[model samples]
Target: MPTPGSTQRKFRLADDALWAEYDQACRDINGSTDRSDDIRKHVEAVVAEWKQRHKMN
Candidate 1:
């Protein structure tokens, strides 16, 4: 659903809560850009950190 003359892409998540969690982490990491997401490695790492914070063990 790209708009004309726009380079942005869109994504859909199954839940808003998951997106909220990722958004918080993204801010902490200064966010992915220039293709730095690299297979979502950074996202996964931050999610691990969030789990640790919540004592999700």
Candidate 2:
């Protein structure tokens, strides 16, 4: 078994290629370039946009 903080953290995806694509695409967001952080920022932005759209209804 892997020990704590002994591996590169990554999000689970349907396929390894998809994860690689996402990892490669992450450049920088609000000064953090980490892939996991990038994914979190993306999800946050999406949810924010969704809330804005729903509020208009």
Candidate 3:
């Protein structure tokens, strides 16, 4: 079995992956068109959601 610290690290990595995916999606969407205020707001929302999930603040 994994140690408690390792379990926490795994959870953190999963959260990081979620953020990375969101960033990649933002880049992909931005690449297909011009950056708009709505897109920026969407990215901010995604980041906020990730931070909340990870208890980062």
Candidate 4:
């Protein structure tokens, strides 16, 4: 039998690989770059693009 939050846990596990890739890419790019400001700007741009495409914000 499953508990109330079991479905949410299963859903998250299914997408774990996707989230891992996103985090890894971000870390790699940020690591190769020396400027914190540039990293912040790039992350903001990516978030904005995702939001626009998904109509999230």
The best candidate in terms of TM-score: 2
Q: In order, how many clashes per candidate?
A: 0, 0, 0, 0
In model 1, the Cα lDDT at residue 46 comes to: 89
**Candidate 2 lDDT by residue in tens digits, 1-57:** 347878764555789897676656664334434766676677999999999999999
lDDT tens digits, residue span 5-50, model 3: 6532122345877766766776797653333444557689999999
lDDT per model vs. reference: 0.65, 0.70, 0.62, 0.63
What residue runs in model 1 are displaced by over 4 Å at the alpha carbon?
1-4, 31-57
Q: Candidate 2 clash total? A: 0
Better of 2 and 4 by TM-score: 2
| TM, every model | 0.38, 0.54, 0.36, 0.38
lDDT of 4 by residue, 1-57 (tens): 346765531223368787667667766877643344455587899998998989953
Model 1 vs truth, CA RMSD: 10.5
Report lDDT (Cα) of residue 2, candidate 2.
44
Q: Considering TM-score, where higher is better, how would the candidates rank from best to worst?
A: 2, 1, 4, 3
For candidate 3, give the lDDT. Answer: 0.62
The ten-residue window of minimal lDDT in model 2 covers: 24-33
Q: Between prediction 2 and prediction 4, which has the larger lDDT? A: 2
lDDT of 1 at 47: 92
RMSD of each: 10.5, 6.1, 12.6, 10.8
Ranking by lDDT: 2, 1, 4, 3
